[model samples]
Target: MIQMKCRVLLFVKKNMPCVKMMKLSPSPDLNPLDYAIWSILMEKACQKPHPNVESLKRALKKAWKGITLVDLVKIVDNFPKRFQACIDANGGHFE
Candidate 1:
């Protein structure tokens, strides 16, 4: 009986979710250009077009390492145009 009780307690403890570590301070300083680029990516993400989300996630992840500020701005600025063209070609807005 004691062994079964101990096993149950151990199982419960093991199944409990771990607590997340909270940040104690603001993130290290980001360059203005970096901030701008990240802001653009975030704004686009919040629109949450499901079909594009995966592609956008991949692009943004890649952008994090390889892209410069200018590239990011260009991508962000062109997003609306690309989206609009798709809509036009499809004959209507995305439902």
Candidate 2:
């Protein structure tokens, strides 16, 4: 079952680039969740240790709430530019 799913995923991954609408690479540079959101969330949530799993969840939730609409909009606004940079680099590393 897993193998079938993997094969289907691989087929999609191979064809997605030909579509030229989205980049399917798992590079951190290509993913805002990695390049931006996680770091922001981590920094905000990990200022101190949590006493337990519930505490950690609460801290993460509060940190997420603290992220402002303007900040999110700015991050989203930069997304296209980042995609262009990735394309300009031919999927290689870029600043």
Candidate 3:
């Protein structure tokens, strides 16, 4: 696993020299997708069971369309407060 990670890092460094990489931790407070988007998508898309993969895909697409620009803006605009909360917890989990 470590070797694969090193290989991926090397590949990224070689292919994307301008990109800066940092170690990432799993913290929903720092990731808008985890904190908000996924739940919204799941709630909207998974309200009923789908008979097959295509049905699920269609449902997800519909749910995605239901998300408005204003909703997205609000989610992004709330990032500073999330960041501050994460910081207040000293990089630990926050509620």
Candidate 4:
């Protein structure tokens, strides 16, 4: 993720010593977790009512648990193609 904002960038620099800072365009569309996992989780969670914090946590946990390795492999396997598309687009929407 591109950490452009000052406060967040400072926080990362202060706390995450091992992390390297790099410049890259924001490409949320090409993020596998955003495109795959979150949409699935949102669909599943929104299908039911989460009336409280516990319920919301429960729903999110269930949704997270439901992501199979097979599904993850499928998503990750598309990364190279997606990254290439992102590069080809010069950081435009690559989804």
Candidate topping lDDT: 3
Candidate 3 residues 1-95, lDDT tens each? Answer: 34544555576667666646655437767776788878888999999999999999999988877876656657756766887888898998888
Q: Can you give the lDDT of residue 8 in candidate 1? A: 41
Against the true structure, candidate 1 reaches a TM-score of: 0.27
Q: What is the per-residue lDDT of model 4 for residues 1-95, given as tens digits with 9 covering 90 to 100? A: 12223445465567666645665425576655676778888887768787888998888888777766556656655656887887899977755
Candidate 1, residues 1-95, lDDT tens digits: the string is 34543554454356533523233213212222333556755655545544666877776665454444445445445544654655576744332
Per-residue alpha-carbon lDDT of candidate 2 for residues 1-95, written as tens digits (9 for 90 to 100): 34543554465457555434355459988776777878888999999998899998998888877876555656656767888999999999887
Where is model 3 more than 4 Å wrong at Cα? 1-26
Better of 1 and 2 by lDDT: 2
TM-score for each prediction? 0.27, 0.63, 0.67, 0.62
Candidate number with greatest TM-score: 3
Ranking by lDDT: 3, 2, 4, 1
Off by over 4 Å in 4: 1-26
How many pairs collide in each candidate, listed in order? 0, 0, 0, 0
Lowest lDDT block of 10, candidate 1: 24-33
lDDT score, residue 21, model 4?
64
- Score each candidate by Cα lDDT: 0.47, 0.73, 0.74, 0.67
